[model samples]
Target: MIIESKVIQGKKLIFNFRSAKKEDASNLSVLRLKIDEETEFLDREPGENFLSPLDFEKLIYEDSISEKNIFLVAEIDDKLVGFARLQGNNLSRFRHKAEFGICILKDYWGFGIGNSMLESILMVADSNGIEKVSLYVVETNTKAIELYEKYGFKREGLLEKDRIHKDGKYYNTVLMGRLANKLKSQ
Candidate 1:
């Protein structure tokens, strides 16, 4: 399930977006840790990622074959700078829905990479008959929230004290979702 696409960033950078490959496992492992360290917005803490390259390779292999899952990477000058994933349930009752998550290096922020990745993933979801896509975002991520909203995702609920950060404080998580049929209707 490879996605072939490209985006221009700030009139200078050219970003290549595609599905993650087994060969990317090593770089992704390192990049994931770096991204987690760069921000508390993600679910993991720095040095908390325990997955090895082999684990990532296995996961990518599984995701590649799963109709309800996709792993995407954004690369600039052949360097992995961002990534996004879509995870869907296998149960009969929840087959029409999926959850999406995205992360980009702090230095690469505001470059339209996230936007491109979301659009591409949504396109894949829609093509695969995924009726709804949902995600959880920390309440303080206004930029991400705004981006999601612009893509027709509505806040469905808030989970209080959902995440504890390095500041030793609890933060709420916003649950947001978008319905493919609804988007088409609107």
Candidate 2:
């Protein structure tokens, strides 16, 4: 699905948000590794579970064809800086829900990129018949937790020892979800 592109003005910086395309595979491959390297907040280690351009291309293609899934990217000056994805389930029992995940370059963390992306994805997901969105955040990430709350996601539960960080400490994961407040009609 094609998403209308929009510019988000951040704290002295601006970026474009749009649906990811096949050509974005290479840049996304590099950016994903960089994002993972920059923080322990994400699930993957820097190089672990790495996705090659082909792998990303496949995902990009699948997302493009899937009505319930979306792959969005953020860029500045034509350079890809961040991305987010909404993955929907196949089974009828879980088809109304999707899992959301996002990542940005560490240098662009506070520029409202994440906030805008979340809002955009949610709006699109609702229009596509997704009634609920879910995500998991590391417990220590107060900034993320606050952002999620501000967007209407409530803490559903906690998974103790969900992650073991680089510092060799166990970290819990906060499970959060939000039901569609207003479903958009196509």
Candidate 3:
């Protein structure tokens, strides 16, 4: 796919929003861990058997051009601060849909980085022939929910008590989705 690069947030940041490169794997993995540490709503802890940076590098090299999977990273001042991924089955029957996920460092949460990253991902998905994109968000992540809603994603269902955190408390998971056609229609 042909991805584009642009700057956002009044030029305070620059977003390439392109396919993840092998060199980016290490930074991407680190950013993922940082995001996980900042948010307790995730299903797993940051140190719980997370994939190695080398493994992520290999995966990115292998699947970088795959139509059913897309990985993106947001860099500012040549540092990776956030990343997003979209994955789906390659089989013809399920090719129209994809699962999406995103993470950003805590310090970058309110700086329009997430919004720019997500918007770029949605555009990439739409251009790649994906009909719908789905994601699960913990109920406590109101800011993320608001961002998703602003981008036209709607709550499709709920998975109650879906995740048990280290605190021994269960949290509800909300499934949200948006159709490319629906977004275009709006």
Candidate 4:
């Protein structure tokens, strides 16, 4: 099934959200590297020495099992600027839920791109019979936490010292989730 696309305008950007294609691997890889370099929450940095094009194609495109995963890309005038992914848990007990993650170029933050991507994902999850969607955000990312809350995701739990950043500081990661029934009622 084709996911519907949407556009949101900001002071300087016209963000477009659409399903990611195989051809988008290269551009998406670049965007991922750039975003990783700018954010401390990501597990690793994708620097000049990292991010092979072949690896991107294999992981993001060729090996993707679309039935259990949905990949979305955000573009501006044909340039890939961000990406969001939803993947279901493999185990039977957790199969009703999906995990989500999104990253936008630092320049694109605050332009509503993140919110749009998230809303789109939630819609997709709801239509696909996904009962719950979950994500983890570093405690310091107040903006993201607020946005998640606005989208009906409540704080589920905290993973104390879940991650250690490059700055030599440990940060807690907060888990949040929302149920499809609750979203529909809203």
**Residue range with the least summed lDDT across 10 consecutive positions in model 4:** 59-68
Candidate 2 minimal-lDDT segment of 10 residues? 177-186
Local accuracy by lDDT, each model: 0.89, 0.92, 0.79, 0.81
Model 1 misses residue 183 by how many Å?
6.9
Q: How far is candidate 2 from the true structure (C-alpha RMSD, Å)?
A: 2.5
Query: Could you tally the backbone clashes for each prediction?
Result: 0, 0, 0, 0
Sum up the clashes in candidate 4: 0
**Could you give candidate 3's per-residue lDDT for residues 117-166 as a string of tens digits?**
78777877888888889999999999999999999899999999999888
Q: What does candidate 1's lDDT look like per residue over 41-149, in tens digits? A: 9888888856789988998998899887899999998999999999888889999999999989998898888888899889888889899999999999999999999
Per-candidate alpha-carbon RMSD to the true structure: 1.7, 2.5, 2.4, 2.8
**TM-score of each candidate structure, all chains considered together:** 0.93, 0.95, 0.88, 0.87
Better of 1 and 3 by lDDT: 1
Best by TM-score: 2
Model 2, stretches more than 4 Å misplaced? 182-186
Highest lDDT scorer? 2
TM-score-superior candidate, 3 or 4:
3
Q: Which digits, one per residue and each the tens of the lDDT, describe model 4 over residues 14-80?
A: 8778887778877877777888889886666457446666776665663255555678889898888
After superposition, candidate 1 runs with Cα above 4 Å error: 5-12, 182-186
Pairs of colliding residues, candidate 1: none
The TM-score of candidate 2 is 0.95
lDDT of each residue in 1-186, candidate 2, tens digit only: 668888888778989999999999999999999999999889999999999999999999999889988899999999999999999888999999999999999999998999998998888877988898999999998999999999989999999998998899999999999888764332
After superposition, which runs of candidate 4 have C-alpha atoms over 4 Å from their true positions?
A: 10-12, 47-51, 59-65, 182-186
